[model samples]
Target: MIKGFILIFLLGASATYCIAQHNKAKSAAIIVTGKVLSQADSNLVKELFFDGLHEKIVNNFQRASTNFNKVLEIDPANDAAMYELANIYHTQNQEADAERLIRMAVTVQPENNWYWLLLADIYKQTQNMAQLVPVFDELIRLSPANEDNYFDKANALLMQNKVNEATAVYNSIEKLYGSSEDLSNARQRILIQQGKPGKAAAELEKLVISNPSDLGNYLSLSEIYAKSGKRDQAIAVLQKAALADPANALVRLSLADHYRALNKPDDAFIELKVAFADPNLNIDDKVRIILSFFPQFADYKARAYADELASITAKTHPDDPKAFSVYGDVLYQEQKYSEAKEEYKKALVLNDQVYQIWEQVLRIDITESKFKDAITDGEAALAIFPNQAPLYLFSSIAYAQSGNHEKAIAYLKNAADLETENKDVISQIFSGMGDSYNALKRYSESDQAYEKALAADPDNSYTLNNYAYYLSLRGENLEKAAKMSKRSIELDPGNSSSEDTYAWILFRLKKYADALIWIEKAMISGKVVNAVQLEHYGDILFFLGNKEQALLQWTKARQAGSASEKLNQKINEKKYIE
Candidate 1:
């Protein structure tokens, strides 16, 4: 009965008569017969339909619904009005109302293909897969020659895991229009999902046999076999593909993948080398394969293989910047920083627009203490990516390292203004500002910068050590300096420089005995005690009344190549000058 009632209430019956015939109708009629009679105007229904469509287009759903409801009121079998109202409800996510109205619409105008498509779309949107199958069946009945409708029905069946029914739909497609690559692939996928790899492989084999000259079909079959864990079968199929087209890079790449999966890395590299040598294989694909080996770069053998592949890539695609980029990445991963920088520079010359390569160039320059290059490259990168905070930060670091404190502060302040969300970058900016201010002998500004740095990152050891050492040097805030210097040592226990700072702070606090103890500890902890540290130890000894030993220590400080004017005065006077 559901299928037979193609056009329910087809007669031009009066509204009262129709309503009286169905007492079980869910809702009251929106339009009374009196209104229809008054508006008994020409093309009244057509006017209302266009009005509804205009309202819907302008997003006036209430007016649109009113117009559509009036259309249905005058003519209860107005499928177009029902469809428009259903689309409105669907847009509002009222799927239940959408489904009900669309069902009525499709049933009222059985031959309207648009109405049936809308019904199918509503079912699909709601994921009402149980009901979806019947809608597609109705569509196929309405549009018998449309091949796409059958495919939709097959996909709907597949969504419900009804593999057998889905297979029947695919077979129907083949029967209607002879076999195609699309149909074969769809059937192969279904069979594979149904745990019928053998059948899936056979399905693809038919394509190869039907068109033996198509190398892609052979690769497709080999891929299916590989996915099914048939290593030997995959290799044999790819070998056949290679023999069919010996110059095909795709075949060589596939063979490499199979060999790599089988743990024959040597065989994989050989195949990759052959593939890389083929100019027909584009550089983008070669770069993708090279990047795919990134996860395995930690292994020495894998790194070696990647190195060899990069060499082949360079030889094959020497003019491409991406080739040099890949070569740089391999060298970067191996910690060959200098070599990596050269490769990155080569890539930059070919293409300077790639931000990642520019970043690499700057990173290696910074890491290898080539600050001049970092500043030059980072400045160029900034012209392209002006708002990039890290570029400003690296430029700041480069300027700071080169003893240009004013330039460093300018770059750090610029970076601080641009960086909002990243607290680490902000903290580093303020810390760099503190160091630059201290270098310029701006004590008040230096103090403020250190405070801001600590507020952002309270445990920044570098900032703590520098701030504390500067305070101790000025002979101010001795107690607070002692605390911060001690914290820095605690944060980095094995850092001899931090230990020396703490000892110097203790010396400034006039705790001579404690200062001597800490300075001795500094000397022992340090790998190679510097001249400043030796001088500090001499000062501590002199404070403890060991004048003779202090002179010997001061002489040693001079020999250690860090003798200041004060230290020379102290040794010549043979006493604590202060």
Candidate 2:
């Protein structure tokens, strides 16, 4: 409410405002060492005072203080000098000196609101609410039309925990100038802060009754009633608000909350659906309500209700990207991948600025094995967010699957650098890099990448299985591969891929009997048999001296759709190759 002085000119302005533009202080040289200069004797008082004004205007407070002090010594009852010196002292944090000087200024010029206002500030600094009341009272008497005086007085009263006095001040505002939001809100807040909810409720109720068109007053009143356990009264207030504003989204939202509190889901959902469908409700607010109030998608009934609301939100706000984004989230949670992608794409069309939405689109593309779509979306995302690690990782996966192993390795390397701290995530990136190198037939680079992956996260089951399998395929480091493969199986128990890698490593190690046990476990434990697992089983069988069974297994491998290059020759020769 007060503009604390900063510049030299503003201090002059304050002096000008207080004195109603008194004549500029003239400069004069006066030596006071000989005797104390009385007010009448020091005919150069105005000149010395103006010199002080000039010094203060230049922001030289020390010089200004000296000039004003001399003026007071000469003119003992100079109110203007007292006010100026008090302001300087207050700015220097000399509150006691400032208080005394300002108090004397107010006593000399009791009709000046500016002096009283400064006095009030000094009282505020000293935390003397008792003196502040009389100061503001005098300010109000001096300028009765200044509403700020009333607010200042009320706030000071509230600081003293004199809530009733504060309420009276607000009431006085209503009497002087009809009931207003500023007055009602201030009074109601103080009453509520004082633990007088009943008084707060009554004050709001009066506003609601006096101005039925003000939906905010009704909502505030309803909240108070609801918090006080007057559920029926709360609902009644919202119901009346609904009557006034039939299509009001906030009213519907309030009604929905009240119905939910009463355990009426059917009624609550009806109100919520209308509220969500209302375009007047800001899209962000709708998203906030759905996220904060609605149950997560894990709850079946709640998911259904939330899905319906999300659909309504999208329909009402077709152009708003957030509405479609949230609806896409609901679909994504329900595992409707294709539909979710379409909704997310719609959001991207409306606005491509949000990285999360683009990430969601790529995530769905990856999940559905849409490598082409994933590549395109990942490229687009990277164009906008070039440093996003997840985008790099996803793009690498898409490129890898599309047989662009060199590009995949590049993206993986960059992603590894970008995502450094999270060991699990970095391990995934390094493991991907290893796979890409292996695909490019750069086995040494592949092995180094795998080692880096393991260094980051020792328990990375995917890395363990893949690295061990790659080593087993090359017939090098079979002993270490066997250990890693076995640990991979232990870390992620019942995963057929890990089990198959372990069994194949055992076969390479010439532990054919142990290999036979694990191959059969992979076959029986898994829902579907892949060609590698079947071919590995054949190799183990032939090595264990079961040539006939090996041929039969090799034929099964050919039909299983991922048979190795040597599988056909092994079946034709009725012997395991490699």
Candidate 3:
């Protein structure tokens, strides 16, 4: 046996990242071979090899490499030791060394299944696909019954786009072990990629005969027929699947897909209803199928179908909270807030631990101006999830809306430390604190909180608009407020709230003509122009010496639910009032 130190350099390129702003390329290396020498003792070589394996298992790759090299020194033709060291080299990303050693090991131990497999793996990892097929072929010759070897060889060939060779490998698999779904599907894929859909259909047809009991095989065959524009043939094959098992729900789903492709949406809906009603199909699979088609359900008609399908899913799986939650999601998206709330309530009754479902219910309550209900529900949810920062933030908003700023402030402070790394959530909590402080007439605290919120997320348009508007209301920092409100409008282009805020800031700065332009833009935005916007428009007009129109707008503001104390005064006195 040869006993000389083999200098195994770990051949990985390392480049220093620039602190000096220049590329400094250098190759970093480590010596992997060992110094320990021994006579050709077979027993000692075996012990050292096992010791090397144990070291590798413990993640001590350097020591493992040392032991393996020592074993190889004791027995120069130790293919097992050579393979282990090659694996270490591969792990270290020393690809050249790994490939060389693995190749040598395979040559030394041609009959060893593992040596050939390692060589195959090395070839694959190096992207040297041209050499991989022969190694897998040798593995097959060595262990002909190993089915994985056949698949690996086919996959390797497919990687090279060797369509003929890959199909041949699949054919060989079928000839040796009979036609199977895996082999036939693999071959059909190659045929399809080769743009021979006709030949792909032939392959699946053969697989359908061999695997006659697998409904999946018939489905695949039907799809291939459809892909090849043989719609009639596809329907006939799906009919066979139905006759094969009259209760198979998947066949109904397949027919629905075919009918949709044929533009017979009504027929598709009928088949979809049949499929959704079948208990044989797993509900989880049904959920996945429906979600996959969500993009197609963007139109009102298809969305209604989606709602119907979601309803069927819920009734089919009445015990599953997820089913009701999905149904609520559909209704919520359609703006059927009341129906969505009922479905969400049903879901909570079944399982109230789901935070997102509670969040959805709370959002609807807030949207519908049910602040007391929102506050109550939020408190119950907080008792269950005490550490959730978003719940506290949302609950504080409800409290603030209910004119309970002290409760809102307490909740917002409690939320400050529970936040995760999401800066938007953190920013929103601070912004909520700002609003609560402003509502309580604590201007200094409100300013500090708004500053902190901007620090967390400088681009938050809500914080910009609110802080600017509050500063304008206090009649302080009019210049700063003008800048911030303008920025808010730039951030959310065409937003009525931001535009109204900008107009109000301009009015506070005594720029009446500029304020009038922005106020008119906000009024015509096609969105709901809230009472505050109308009141601001009246103030802007009054400042611009249009008292008649200004008083008219103030009345409109009061009529539109302005709850502002100065609004009635402005209309009755026929002048602008803050």
Candidate 4:
């Protein structure tokens, strides 16, 4: 979700304005055609003007512009006023006005290090490195002792692809400060960039040896080693760094990432937990590390981490209710149902404002088939976050399972109202409702639910097969049943239930020859081995003058658990003697 240029945008905006202002001030001096600052009493004027300028910073560009104009009117050589005005205009994105002021500022204060560095940052933002190179040169001349100045100058040179110049400045800094840690670090980066990773590694090693306790230096060494295919060395360096600064979560996180990359997921998770325990660790990192546990371990680990996290938070914020909800999630994931219920109860006790958590508890109860408990939870969830879909869906299923068809149908209707666009879900709920009604022998209500499902998806294969089979069983709408059965078979030619429905429909219509053909076809479809289809086929055969084989088929069907007991009796009793 986060990207590379975000850092640039965060820190670059102010620096960009500074550089743009400097460029403008220089051009303004050329245009004004006069000395921007007078030699007579310049220091006294600068001191007096600097305080007023500092105070004027709070003024907006409109007020600041008027004030700057007054300063310039009093003394036409007031370069400081011009520079301040330039900064204000640049901040306002009035680039042309800012440019006019900055050109004058730089012309008046050409030798100023601040003016030159500010110009360099603008050039960097605009990617105008050619103009930036000379500004840094002037900057270095103005402030040679400022180590950061040299470092910045080298970086500007590096950006311009002037590698040799960049390396020379870095070396000069090193010679001046005799293996200075910062310069040493900078030189190592240059070495890596120039394809001398071995040299970079050696340079970092020397720096770490001299500054044994510098965590940044050790991290640098680890990075170099890892990049250079020396992972063992990288791990050793991180371990040493972590040992030196045991409280640094960054080092611990790096160590975990390193272990994860090495195929030691368990070890990685341990380091992650350690990092998570550190109060100084970023909350985002802690959450990420906790989430990275393997899915198989999520149940146990999320629960344990949630418990630890709760304890840690509650130690300070003892009255917080959200922590209990977090704990409940972990327990629920682990299927510790009673413990989870207790936690949810604790959460509600602390605050009854958690609607979603109530829904979660209800879901858990529904999953465990605690129908009465589920209704209580669902009612609570609905009271808070009214019209929540999961609550209705789960409550409907639970009510249906508990043999409360009226409550189940009511809940299903509510679910349908809430999720109108989920036609498939609505269809499934209606189909299930129909099945429940049929079980209660409420034929008209069952038929209406089935019709509702068919209206949602006219050719839904499962619904077609089910409704058609129901009709054939009731000995009604035989023609319509045959059409729906054929449609089901067309939808999924190899589906066993569809095949069984088609064969059974043919047998119900007493089309014995056609029934035999389809029963054989259903067998060849290879999706089902239904005993009912086998027995029906035997009946067709017996009706078609194949008595011996018909008896054999019936015997097989009976062994296969067909409703063939009556057929077996009739065959044994010679009831079909013709």
Candidate 5:
């Protein structure tokens, strides 16, 4: 093996000597070698070289060492070959061999920053920070004017937990480069990490002020302020940035978010209005923001914006139904249902293929308990998009609400069959079927449907709570119902409906004290608390011999919307104190 190696090296050395002696002859030799290298045949010299490299790379260290040595014999000063040989030694856990080869490569190419960088990388990989520092220092010295060298050196210092060194290097780069955004950003990050947020904010603010066209500076300043927990200052900065560039839609949107965070809904809406008018913002996003704030603004502003949206839709997207659909959404959020319905109809007329508008109309009908109308709209939507599972789900719900359980189950089953991989969708469909069966007093069928729902989504809080409540109402499966109720509460402690179900299940089992605790928890969980839950709480208190508190709770339930005969009977039977 050693004799073969010596022969190969001698052949290449002889070629070099011949080239030095006869330049014209060397040029001809180079052309011949180029021709051989350019050939498509695998038998070519370059192809063999690449094949050997590939064979080395595919094997472990033993094969790689031999192949890389052979490559070095063919081309004595190949830095890439030396680097690969070093990598092979390193991967084989031969640290001494790797370091020796890498150091020799760097010494041979003293001007090559890449060789220095590779040495630094090897030191970093081995966690030799002391060795890495000197090597990187040499690299930066050789490439002093290159920004990447400075940046990489700074990053390496930062990784070594040398914050002051990193900061100083970043500052040096920034001073020399004159406000390069990357160096400026690096300085700010280091300052913030060093707990000098004030200095960071000041630098960023100046950067933003000087470079007003660079909105990223303003955004970074806002982030820095927000990270420092100075939200009011952040918002104020964004507001100024918006005023500085009113025509910038992104700045206006950012300003609107700031206003929204400050609870200044009217101010946010005004900014959003200007942003939406720019034609730069995505129409869908603009419309969504407009609708979201429409409900919060005064009625006149909502009406005016709704009119503006309609005008924009008519002028810009005359052929598109999505604009009209957005107009409908804004109107609907403002409780202008009749106008919203007309807009939806107009959208549908413009493009009957848009199933979402049909679904939107169906949702409105469902909200108003217009089950027949909901069913009609849902069916119309399904006609356009037969495989749309949400449309099928809505159709089943509307049919069930209208007392057609058979058709409801059929639609729900169709949805379930189509979305077998989507567990949440299947669970929801089966839950809808269970609700329909329960409404029709088919207890056995309801039980089966509920079981199907649980099987699909074992931890679904909504399905667990509703199905458990139904079980309690039927006076069977009390223990299973109690367990399910507890599970629902554990999954979503803040869900008022789930809490109510748990409390009611406890009441059914005559655990009155435990029932009252959970009932009160449900009542307090919501700001606009459910009336039915309050009445249930009152009933639990009444059973616990707290007549006065029970009456008070029952009265509050009446105010919220429970006008049941049972509640009225309790109020009449219980005497009040003057």
Candidate 6:
């Protein structure tokens, strides 16, 4: 009996093994051809699918597509193979083929999340908003708890101008995840886009009540109110936000804006001061606020506020070069040039790569008459930006101011060479060259450069005055010099320098009577008479045969510093010694 039981057990075990093998073969067949496949064919299809994936990864798209096609030929229902082929087509911008293949893949394996996502992306890429809606709907159905899928559906609906439907989707998200500021804001935007700002404001109000501690909600509501012209309502919302989050700098800024709009200048300034005092406010925003005060700079109160705000920016953002740079701009505009130069230098020490800052620093140095510093800084700037004509021009000015006429001419030539189609810059360069050459006693070159400068800018008063003065000093071209000097005076009436040049040119022509009148005008036109003007007046008076009065003027010229050596000789000799 034991032998018989053993044989029966063996037979039942063999039958169970056969049935399991048969079911496995049937599953493989469904995967391949929806019919039974031989074990060899199933293995080959699997091999091809993996090889296609490897080829795709290696960017061998043609080979990848070939292998995928072979796998699909062997197993027509292979959704993964279809998806891979669709990806290759998508990459090639064959969207129609991609769409057809991906749709087939989704249809074959409707529950494949990746397949649905690819289809949705394809719809989005094609801008087929209408088609994208159902794909996102399917995605939502597939992944019911996925919040991103709901957002995608809402966006698709919004693209179709289906505001109500989009709002419903956003509402669905809130239901799934509880109330959120993002959802509320999204709904608000949709309502606002639909021209129902009242509804939008209502939506944001709901968020504010739900999350009273969140200042962002209040700010959003205030913006909407402001945009809708409810100025008082906007101010009230911002005030509530500030009370809720007293430390928020952005809220304070918004409050300042609203207060200003309400025409309450004191309230506006108070809020602005609070906002600017906050260390948490970003440097860029502070810079913007400071810039807004530019138009109001003529008002003492506005100027003081701007100055205080700039100081705060410097303190809060000590390492930020922009902070100091912007402050320097404010001071420079106010004509506090020396202080502006210090600020720009501080900014450069922090960060020297900004070209605009370099420009500002050099400009301020020139304005403050820091000639040595300007030359040092301008040369460094030129090294970094050799092609910049403005840098060359600035460097030339620095060299000229420092009495390096040869170097000045070289730098000015470089500026003229680099400047194209900018007649103003070219004119300035030639004018500078004229000055440098004249200083070096290269009178012919100086005269040529001056002519070119006048050709470029006929109304250049500075050039006219300097050119006429140089010609008069040389005792050549007196008539032309007199005409240019007169034109310079006409262009810049009451300019002491032009008046002095005309008077000197008149003296050179031996018109002593005419020279006396202009020399006197030059001395009185300026707030202070310089040693040069006093000496010139002495010479004109002596030429007109007033020895005693001329001697008196010479003594005064000596009292003023910078009187020429000849003035001392003439004073000692008790006569004109020209």
Best by TM-score: 1
Q: How many backbone clashes does candidate 1 have?
A: 0
What Cα-based lDDT does every candidate model obtain?
0.84, 0.83, 0.82, 0.71, 0.75, 0.84
Per-residue C-alpha lDDT of model 5 across residues 342-394, encoded as one tens digit per residue: 78898899888876677788778877788888888887788788898878888
TM-score of each: 0.77, 0.76, 0.71, 0.58, 0.47, 0.76
Those runs of model 4 whose alpha carbons end farther than 4 Å from true positions after fitting are 1-125, 131-150, 171-180, 242-283, 286-364, 403-414, 420-578
Provide the lDDT at 269 for model 5.
63
Off by over 4 Å in 1: 1-76, 84-94, 180-183, 246-253, 273-297, 306-330, 338-361, 384-386, 507-531, 537-563, 567-578
Winner of 3 and 4 under TM-score: 3
Error of 6 at 29 (Å): 31
Lowest lDDT 10-residue stretch of candidate 2: 5-14
Q: What is the C-alpha RMSD of each candidate to the true structure, in Å?
A: 6.4, 8.6, 9.5, 10.8, 12.7, 10.8
Model 2, span 1-578: residue lDDT tens: 32222211112112223334554323321111223454565667787788999999999999999989888776666779889999999988899899777766665566787787887888898898866876677788779998988998999889898888887888898899876788888877887797788999998988887888999999999998988889899989999999998888888988988898788988998988878777888888888877653455577877788778889989999998998898898888889889888899899899999999999998888899999999999999999999889899999999999999999988997898799788887898989999999988899999999999999999999999999999989999988998899889889999988888888888888899999999999988889998888888888988888888888888988998854567888877787666
Q: By TM-score, how accurate is candidate 3? A: 0.71
Pairs with steric clashes in candidate 6: none
Q: Spell out the clash pairs found in candidate 3.
A: none
- Model 3: per-residue Cα lDDT over 1-578, one tens digit each: 54445432222211111212343323333333434444447678878899999999999999999999997776665678889999899888898998777765654556677777777777888898777776776778788999889999889889999878887888788888985677778877888888988988887777778777888888888888888889979989998988888767889889988998899988888888888898667888777766755686677777878889889999998888888898898888889998999999999999999999988989998899899989999998999989888888888889999999999989988889888588998899889989989988999999999999999999899999999999999999989988888888888988888888888888888888999999999888737767888888888888888888888888888889977677888887888655
Cα deviation at 58, candidate 2, in Å, is 17
Model 6 segments more than 4 A misplaced: 1-128, 171-179, 190-203, 379-389, 413-421, 509-521, 538-555, 568-578
Query: Candidate 5 at 121: error in angstroms?
Result: 10
lDDT accuracy of residue 209 in candidate 4: 86
